[model samples]
Target: MCSNLQKAMIDLIEVFHSYSGKEGDKYKLSKEELKTLLQNELSGLMAESKDPAVVDKIMTDLDENQDGEVDFQEFVVLVAAVVVACHTFFEDLDKGNVTPCSRS
Candidate 1:
């Protein structure tokens, strides 16, 4: 069996492809695909998705090349960022620095 970390890496690749290639660029994620991926996969982590501009902002920020799409490398950046944020959130909660139930 693969190690837990290997499984996580595979899962990330699967999740990325699962949302990409609907319209164009089979290897990249368009804006709509990115939004769907976030809404579907990160719904709980991204409660602010209610804001329509959230996706727009994400796309703009992740599209470092300004090509209007996110390639695998770019997608990895987003995943890493989210993972880091989650780590920080949990770490803070553990130290009593953040309250999960607190309103943002």
Candidate 2:
């Protein structure tokens, strides 16, 4: 069985490929492109904290090496975090621990 982390990584890759319109493009992402993509496609997932400060803090925290942007590895980490958050949220719902709600 694939670990949750591994599954999350796979899901992230699928999302990235879809966003880039290059499902087969495994090429490295430029810093600017990465930032833009994250801000656009990942805003909702990352914004779940309902706090801009928290979201910004998470973004900065993932930008390791102080490069002012995220690389593939860093992006993977960010996606993994989002995936975990999503999984936990769903799991809570499954257990009837969370109110039934939809973002849309």
Candidate 3:
């Protein structure tokens, strides 16, 4: 059986491919694809954001090459960032520096 971390890596790749190539390049995520992925797969995370420009902001940030689309490398950067953020949150919670309800 695959290890938990291995499974997570596989799942992440699958999720990215599942959203990419719907509108354009088969290997990259256009703005719409990224938006759809966030709304559908990450609804809880996206829901907490009240910014109307969040998607645009994310797209701009992730498109590191400024090619107008997010390729797999760029996509991984976003995933890493999120993972780091979650790690930090849990670390803070464990240290009693944060509360579950106050993680804003």
Top-lDDT structure, candidate number: 3
lDDT of 1 by residue, 24-99 (tens): 9989999999988987898886685567698899899999999999999999999899889989999999999989
Estimated TM-score for each candidate: 0.90, 0.57, 0.91
RMSD of 2: 5.6
Per-residue CA lDDT of candidate 2, range 1-102, in tens? 999979977877876654542323344444445556767887665455566476457557877877554556777787677679889988998898988555
**Residues 12-83, model 3: lDDT tens digits:** 999999999998899999999999999998788899999999999999999989999999999999999998
Clashes of 2: 0
Candidate 3, superposed: residue stretches over 4 Å from native: 102-104
- For model 1, the superposed segments whose C-alpha errors exceed 4 Å read 102-104
Model 3 Cα displacement at 85 (Å)? 0.4
Tally clashing residue pairs in candidate 1. 0
Superposition TM-score, candidate 2 onto the true structure:
0.57
CA lDDT, candidate 1, residue 9? 95
Query: What value does the lDDT take at residue 30 in candidate 3?
Result: 97
Provide C-alpha RMSD values for all models, in order. Answer: 2.6, 5.6, 2.3
Residue clash pairs of candidate 3: none
Worst 10-residue lDDT window for candidate 1 reads: 43-52
